[model samples]
Target: MTLFIGIVIFLVTFVFMEFMAWFSHKYIMHGFLWVLHKDHHHKDHDSWFERNDAFFIIYAVVSMSFIITASNTWFWYGLPIGFGIMAYGAAYFLVHDIFIHQRFKLLRNANNWYARGVRRAHKIHHKHLGKEEGECFGMLFVPFKYFKK
Candidate 1:
């Protein structure tokens, strides 16, 4: 029963993180923190990393808090939740950074329909180099209109 609960917690947390990602990207990142996220849309630095990458630290601290709470407190479900958040982060990095942005030289040839759709949606998001008037969608759950037929 505990294992099943843990798995459920993990899956639920993973799905919830998608909504959180979209919310934060639209409101927080594009809101006051546009100073950081704008560089992602516009190239102002020569380094391999963007100031926008700082956002990950917030999620990292959150995930670590969950793991530490699980270790020292009664909230054992935090373990699964932490892992779920980390897993979603991994997926976002793989799809957004590695596959879509080509931050690394891998996953560049994933020419499937889903991959194309994700890329197209992201392309639309990046079309606006500013904070306002941008459409921020979930990483895994893009609109069907963005997908190809």
Candidate 2:
């Protein structure tokens, strides 16, 4: 029962994570909270926290709560929710820190199709002015033309 529940949670969480990625990037990261995220772009060197990657801390805590209490279906709902949040964090960490920004480029070695797409998309986002940040709102599945304009 526990393992089955975990698998179910994982699939649901992937969807939720994708949606959360869209929402947070579209509204939060590019919106008012860009003040903190801006440090990531402007700083010459990034410390452990200055990278502004700590945003996932909140998601981790919330998802952990659900996983811990997931005996019931109600709690099981949190499995996917938590997984989604973690997925976003992982995607952000891998894509932004590893590929696009090259903050931790040592760990990155290859440039696959998705990686190239995401890097190009994010580059376009960075090149645009503040008002034009809307082009690459979707992180994992964005169309290239969205940023071409």
Candidate 3:
């Protein structure tokens, strides 16, 4: 029962996280909240925690509380949702902080697929001033279709 619940939690959480990533990237990061996110782009290399990554903290607190309460009361439903949010955060960390920004350069070899995709997309995003502002606003996966003129 525990294993099944965990798996379900992870999958559901993953989906929710993806949607949240997209929504937040599109609206929050690119929206009125750019002040916070702008620091990610221009600041002179600060501590990992110094970046405006607090949104994740807010998200974790809210989602964790809801998940815990739901798990205790409603049982398994909360598991997936909570896990999904976590998965999204993980993805964002990898795609946004690591690959896209070249912060985690260990996997930057031109041969690697993740390195190539994320780096290229991010470069293109940075190439334009008005359009691609900060983050790609597409999370881990930015299909070429999105960049079409």
Candidate 4:
């Protein structure tokens, strides 16, 4: 029963991370913290990294905290929660950075309906080079309108 509960908690946390991603991207990243996220939209530096990468570090720290707490506490639930957050972060990095932005050039030839849709939606979002007026959407749950025919 404990294992089952842990699995459920993990799945729930994974799904909830999507909402958290959208919320943070829209309000926090594009809002007051635009200073960190602006370089993501506009390439102001020659380096391969952006200040926006700090957000990934923040999430990584949160996941690590949960894992460490789970290791020391009786509540093993934090283990799954931590893995769930890390998994979502991995997916986000692959889809957003690798696939969409071609940062690593690994999944460069992945051509599919879903991939195309994600690319299209992200392109629209990047259409605006500023903090405001860009359409921010979840990586896993892109709008149907952006889907290919």
Candidate 5:
């Protein structure tokens, strides 16, 4: 039963990360920390990397901390939570960076309805260069209106 509970916890954590992503993007990324995230929307640097990449590092550290704690009394929960966070981070990277932004030049040929919707939503969000006017949405949860037939 412990293994089942861990799996459940992992799924829950994975789902919850969507809300966390949306919240952080809307508030923190577009809020006071816009200085870090602004370059992501606007191409001011010649380098492929942006200061906004720091957010990924922050999340990696948080996920690693949970994994490290799994050796302790919190093993059951910590293990699942850590993996869940890491999984979500991976998905976010693939979808937001590679697929949507074409950072890696892969997954560009995905032209299904879901892929089109995600790309459309992200395009709308990026239409605003400034942080104040940009719309925020989670990597996996684009608005229904964006998913037009």
Candidate 6:
């Protein structure tokens, strides 16, 4: 593919990952796989990591597989796709782990409209502490109601 097309594909993939994050968080994480995701809602462990972190490894493996395929095979578009997944994963880590959960005591002063909205939405979501009756499964694309002044 052309450079422009590759960039477009990369951008699209980045955007698409938001929806995937939402869908996976709602249906998969909160569904049959709640056993792994429950720790994220509640701090039942003394360790710094949660069982939900397994999903990061899964996505890393997927991105690495795409990259390996691109390097060894003829499908070069996989490079953009792989990087897009990796970039989204990094953003998710920053926003969810660092900003929202304060896992590292960073971004605690972001205090912007988007930051406030995201934090509020996530706080509302964590209020459930259970798989069912959860709201705001999204990370980036939060509902506007949370942003209202």
Task: Give the Cα lDDT of each candidate.
Answer: 0.92, 0.66, 0.66, 0.93, 0.92, 0.90
lDDT of 5 by residue, 1-149 (tens): 98899999999999999999999999999998999999999989899999999999999999999988996764658989999999999999999999988899899789999999999999999999998878889977788998988
Model 2 over residues 38-131: C-alpha lDDT tens digits? 6655564636567456566766787677766665656656666666567767876776676666666464666676666676777677775463
lDDT (tens digit, per residue) of candidate 4 on 97-131:
98889899798888888888999999999999988
lDDT at position 84, candidate 3: 73
C-alpha displacement of 140 in model 6, angstroms? 2.0
Error of 1 at 99 (Å): 0.6
Question: Which residue pairs of candidate 1 clash?
Answer: none
Give the TM-score comparing model 5 with the true structure, all chains together: 0.96
Worst 10 residues of 4 by lDDT: 105-114
Worst 10 residues of 1 by lDDT: 140-149
* Model 3 global lDDT (CA atoms, 0 to 1): 0.66
Kindly report which residue stretches of model 3 are placed more than 4 angstroms away from their true locations once superposed: 1-9, 44-48, 128-137, 144-149
TM-score of 6: 0.96
Model 6, 7-46: lDDT tens per residue?
Answer: 9988988888999999888899999899999999988999
Model 2, poorest ten-residue lDDT window?
128-137
Count of backbone collisions within predicted model 6: 0
My TM-score estimates for the predictions, one after another, are: 0.98, 0.72, 0.71, 0.97, 0.96, 0.96
Task: Please say which candidate is ahead in TM-score: 2 or 4.
Answer: 4
Off-target runs (Cα >4 Å) in candidate 1 are none
Tens digit of per-residue lDDT, candidate 1, span 29-104: 9998899899999989899999999988889889999999999999999999999999999888888889999999
Root-mean-square deviation per candidate: 0.7, 3.8, 4.1, 0.8, 1.0, 1.0
